[model samples]
Target: MSQPDQAPDQAPDQAFDVIISGGGLVGLTLALALDQGGLKIAVIDRLAAEAVLEESFDGRAAAIGFAAYRMMETLGIAQHLGEVQPIEHILVSDGRIGTPGRQGGPSALTLHFDHRETGSGTEPLGWMIENRRNRLALDIQVATRPGITRFTQDEILDIQVEPGAVRAKLKSGTKITAPLLVGAEGRGSFVRKKAGIRTYGWGYDQTAIVTTVAMEQPHGGVAHEYFLPTGPFAILPLTGNRANIVWSEKTSRAKALLSLSPAALEAELARRFGDFLGKVTLDAPVWSWPLSLELAATWAKPRITLAGDAAHGIHPIAGQGLNLGLKDVAALAETLVEAKALGQDLGDLTVLERYAQWRRTDTMTLAISCDAFVRLFSNDIGPIRALRTLGLGLVDALGPARRFFASHAGGDVGDLPRLLRGESLSPALN
Candidate 1:
C-alpha cells in the first residue's frame, strides 16, 4: 500500500475498465456498482480515505430514498451502514416565524405524507444516515472487493480522450487508462471540464444551515418542512431522540445567525423549531452550504461521462441531491454493464448517450421542481401564500395526488434500473 498522502513510486501504470474521478459518495457507489457487474474499476480521489472517513470531516447526513437504498443493498453496501433512521411521515406547512401553536409552530394548513399512503404499505419514504457513516460503509465495501482499486490523496493532472480510451495522468506521476472515464467529483468536475462540457446554473442567494440536534421527545419518524418567508426549515428525523436540521435562509441572515454565540444560535433555532419535538439542543457543530441550481449542457462526451453533482447540482429543498446522484450511478452502471456484455465499446458515444438519455428528463424535472419550490415557498405574498397553502392541502386531501407525490419522493417514479429495482446488475438479468 502507498504511504498516506504519497503515491508509491514503484506503482506501475494501470488500466481499468472504468476510471472514476473523485471517489466521493457518488463516485464510490458507481465504482462498486460496476465492480459488482464484473467491471474492473479505478477510483482516484484527491482526498485520502482516512481523512474523509473521520466523524468530524463531514457532519451532514443524507436522506436515502427507498430506491437508492435498494441500490445500495443490491450492491452489498447497506450492511456496513452502522445505524439509520426511517422517515415514516413528512409534514409540509407554510407559516410565519412567530405563528402560534406549540409555541411558534406550523399553520393548520399543511400537506401530510404518510408512508402507508405511498402504496408501499409498511415501507418508509427513505432512510437517513450520516455522511461519514455512508463513507465508512463504502470504504468497508470497497476494501472487500478486489475488482475495485482506490488511489487516494491523488488527483488527475490531465486527461487525454483517445478514440478507444481515456488516459489520465495523476499529480503523483501515475498514469491510468480506461475504456470510460466518469466525473463524479461534484460541481467543479475535472473530467467534465476536460471534456469541454459547458454548464448552466445560478445561485439562489440562500444558504442552508445544517446541524444535528438532540430532542427531548422522539420525532416519531416524522420529517417536518416549514416554509417561512426566508426559506424552508426542515427537521429530518434521526435515530434515537435526534433530528437533522436543514434551515435555509437568506445568505445575509444565515451569515449573521452563524456568527452568533452558541446560546444565541440555539435560541434562533428554537423559535423556528417550535416545541413539536420538545426542546432541541445542538449535538454537532453547525455547517452551512450555499444553495444553487446547476446542470451540465450534456452528461456525456465520447470516452468521458458525468454522474451525480457533476452532471446536475440541484437545490436541496427536497433532499434529493444524493438520491439523484445514486440514480445516475444505477443508470450508468446498467448501461455500461449491458453494453460491455454485447461486445460494444464502453467509451463509444452511442453507448454513453443511452445512459444520458435515460437520465436527462428525470434530472431536469427534479431540478426545475426543486427550484420552483424554493421560489414559490420562500415568500409571504398574501395571495400567493394562500394559493400555495391551498395547493398543499389539496394535494394532501386527494389520495391519488398524495400517493403520486409520495411515490415520487420515494424515487419510485419513471423507469428504474436493475439496481434500483433491487435486482443484480449482472447482464444475465437483462
Candidate 2:
C-alpha cells in the first residue's frame, strides 16, 4: 500500500535532478536507480498508483533475465517481488497445431537452453513475474526512498527544454523542472513526439493473445516456445500449476479467437498447448494486442532522452522487451550518476550521448533478430521449414553454440553496466 509522495491537488512547483514521463516499468526503475545513486527524481504517470496494481490494468507477465534480476536484487526490489517462477529450462521447437513429435506432439527437433549451461548450474535462466506484481514491488521500493516524488493520476501538458534545464507543466497545474527529462512511456510516447523524434518501424501482421492457464500437472519451471504456422506460442511457467500464455497469430485469426466463448477458446488453446503439461484450461481473462517493430530515430536530444518501449518496440517472439529497457535504465543511471560526481551537466548532449551509444547496437541487434525469428518460423513453407528445423537441431547439438545462446537469453551478453552486473553504482562515482 505505497502512496504517492505528492497528491496531485497538493503538488507545488518543485525541481528535481531528473523528471521522468511515464511511470511504467522502465521509468519507475530509472527513478529507483537514480534515487539509489543520491539523485532526486520526479515520476509522473497518467494512471493512479492503485490502478496500476489492478489485475485488469495489465494481464501480461515479463521474463526477467538473470542479469536484470540481479539488477533488481541490487536495487532492493527483488525481495519484495512475491510469487515469481524461475525459468529453469527452455524448449524451443517448430510445428503446426496438433503436429506430432518423434515421441509425442510438436516437432521432432528442438533447441534446448538449460540453466545449468550458464556456468552457475543452480541459477535459473530468468524469472517470470506478473506485471502487476512487478509494479507492486516497484511502488513499495519507490516509497522507501524519500528522493523519489511520484505524481500519479496526472499528465504532462507541456515541456520546454531550455538552457541547462527541462521544465514540465502538468495538466494539474503543477510545474516541475529538472536537468534531464526521460521518456520511458510506451511506444506512443508524448515526450518523444514532443521532442520531434521520428521513429521507423511497421506493424506486424500478428497479434498477441495473452492470458494465464492452469495446467493439471506442474510446469516444472520449464518454458516452451512452440513455433507454429501462425506464430510463436509461448508457455511460460508461473507459481503453482499455472502458466502465462503469449500466443501470437495472424490479426484476423486472433480477432476471431478472442471473439469466442471461454470454453471455445480453451479448446483452441489445447490444440496447440499439447498434453505435455497435462490438461490446460483458461484461468484468466484473455487480452490481445497487435504486434509491431518500432525503433526511435535517436535516443538523445539535448536535455531529453528516451528509454524502454519509448525508444524501441520489438516483437515478443523473444521476451527481451523489458530486459532491453532495464539495460537502458542501468546505462542511463550510470552515465548520470558518474556525470554528477564529476560536476558535469546532466542535460548536455555530450553527456547523454554516452548512454545512447552504449545501447544503440545492442538494441538494434535484438530487434532485428526478433523480427527475423517471427518471419522465419511463422511460415509453413516447405524448404524454409525444413531448414529452420535443421538449424534448431544443429544449434542444440553444438555445446558452445547452445551455451552461447543460453547466456544471450540470460542477458549476459554485451557491455553491462554496474547495476546489471549486480554491483552498486557508488563505485562509478569514485
Candidate 1 Cα outliers beyond 4 Å, as residue runs = 1-12, 100-102, 427-430
Lowest summed lDDT across 10 adjacent residues in model 1 is found at 3-12
Reference-based lDDT, each prediction: 0.89, 0.90
Give the per-residue lDDT of model 2 (tens digit) for 354-381.
Answer: 9999999999989999999988999999
- Please identify model 2 stretches exceeding 4 Å from their true place: 1-12, 100-105, 427-430
Winning model by lDDT: 2
RMSD (Å) of each candidate, 1 decimal = 3.0, 3.7
lDDT of 2: 0.90
Count of clashing residue pairs in every prediction:
0, 0
Q: Worst lDDT window (10 residues) for model 2?
A: 98-107
TM-score of candidate 2 on Cα atoms, chains taken together: 0.95
Q: Give the TM-score of candidate 1.
A: 0.96
